[model samples]
Target: MKRFALIFLFTFLLSPKIYSQRCGGGILTFNIYTLNGEDIKEFDYEIFPVSKELLQKNLYEKVVNEQNMNNSDYPLFKSVETSGRIIGKVFVDQIIDNNNPKLNAKLQELLDTSAITQKGTITSTLLFSTRENQSFPIVLKISNGDREVYILGNYFGNCDREASLVWGDKVLKLE
Candidate 1:
């Protein structure tokens, strides 16, 4: 009885840490827009929680293995850590407009079927520019799902070219 109780306690204690080692959770929707407020890209991303194990793996793959550097060398890859433990695998969706009749119809149908309300909601905006010299901003709004929201934005600054959003001492950049 004593051994069984010890094993059970140990297992329970370690379960959360073990499971949180990789990304897995809910879907995050990111709506990307031009600086002029034109919606250009919409993506639904699978959110994952970042752990120390994940950080080590990413550093090894991108830095040590890919760049052929020693572990003691400066990191060649960057990692974003959020106050929350969720990262997303971004999946691009087809661009559509609110003015599009077909899309409007579909949206109305969804609204009719779903009992969605924006009571407890959080929104994060990330502004960035692409290699094409196009400047844009993305708005990420999360509601009625996970308790925490994670969003990262990266881009060169228009004025200084070194400005970045700092959250909890972590610099967020577009992946």
Candidate 2:
């Protein structure tokens, strides 16, 4: 009985650490394009998932409150809450397989083909916070080759218009 108890306790203590390391988060990839469809930049972001406690401690109060108050406006908040599951699918379809039939068809319908080009790789990290009854608030630290851009906003909602860099005074949209 003593040995069995010891074994069970040891396993229980070790399980969380092992599980967190493996399942805490995932990588997200995306392209940056001019409204004209020119893909001038790409990013491979590694997101580290955080617990509710950690999120609250790290994120800004306004960001957290906005997520709680405007839950219905942002679909990406749900993805962030789940630590990028939905966003992962978007990344796969949009960034990994450009020839994916469904996405390609959709893009063809929505965008002009003349301006799109695939190029560049930048690495970055995403940060966020969540409450029990509210959506998550997210921020991105985008590394653009030699420069870094910090984007502050909810995951899928309108990013701060002033937060963008690299476009050199031109207003660009992030799809």
Candidate 3:
């Protein structure tokens, strides 16, 4: 069942011409910066979901095959490439290490079998924008020389069934 699900998800994500945003809203990818008057990077992002795929079995009966799904599914994001110059000091960062003993133990506690979970691990992303003249947002998680930056907010929604990113208080509805 898990194998079927992984394949279903991969095919949907790798396909082109996917719906560009969540069910009702669109994606917001903007520039990120540091506190010392520097633009860190501009991220290209997207959130979207699967178009319901109908299937046929041995008997040729129509089958609604929803893969390993939860109420809130993760978004299918593809980074856009641009030749525009990034005018800022390069920031060195590290991906969260999965092998750390504490994180390893925490991973188990965070994962749930019955429902899709992301409490312990970095599973979701939030986007934010500030009109103030400040260069950086409020939160930056730096570990092992890597800084994890995100829009800090709490949200609850279904991603296992659709492609979406909560991104602060607003629920971006990808089609």
Top-scoring candidate (lDDT): 2
Q: Determine which window of 10 residues in candidate 3 has minimal summed lDDT.
A: 77-86
lDDT of each: 0.30, 0.35, 0.26
Instruction: List the candidate numbers ranked by lDDT, top first.
Output: 2, 1, 3
Query: Which model is ahead, 1 or 3, in terms of lDDT?
Result: 1
Sliding window of 10 residues with minimal summed lDDT for model 1: 153-162
Candidate with best TM-score: 2
Write the residue-wise lDDT of candidate 1 on 79-146 in tens digits: 22111112343311111133446544543443233232212222333222222221211113332233
Give me the runs in candidate 1 sitting further than 4 Å from their true place: 1-34, 39-48, 62-120, 124-175
State, as a TM-score between 0 and 1, how close model 3 is to the true structure: 0.18
Better of 1 and 2 by lDDT: 2
| lDDT over C-alpha atoms for residue 38 of model 3 | 37
The TM-score-based order of candidates, best leading, equals: 2, 1, 3
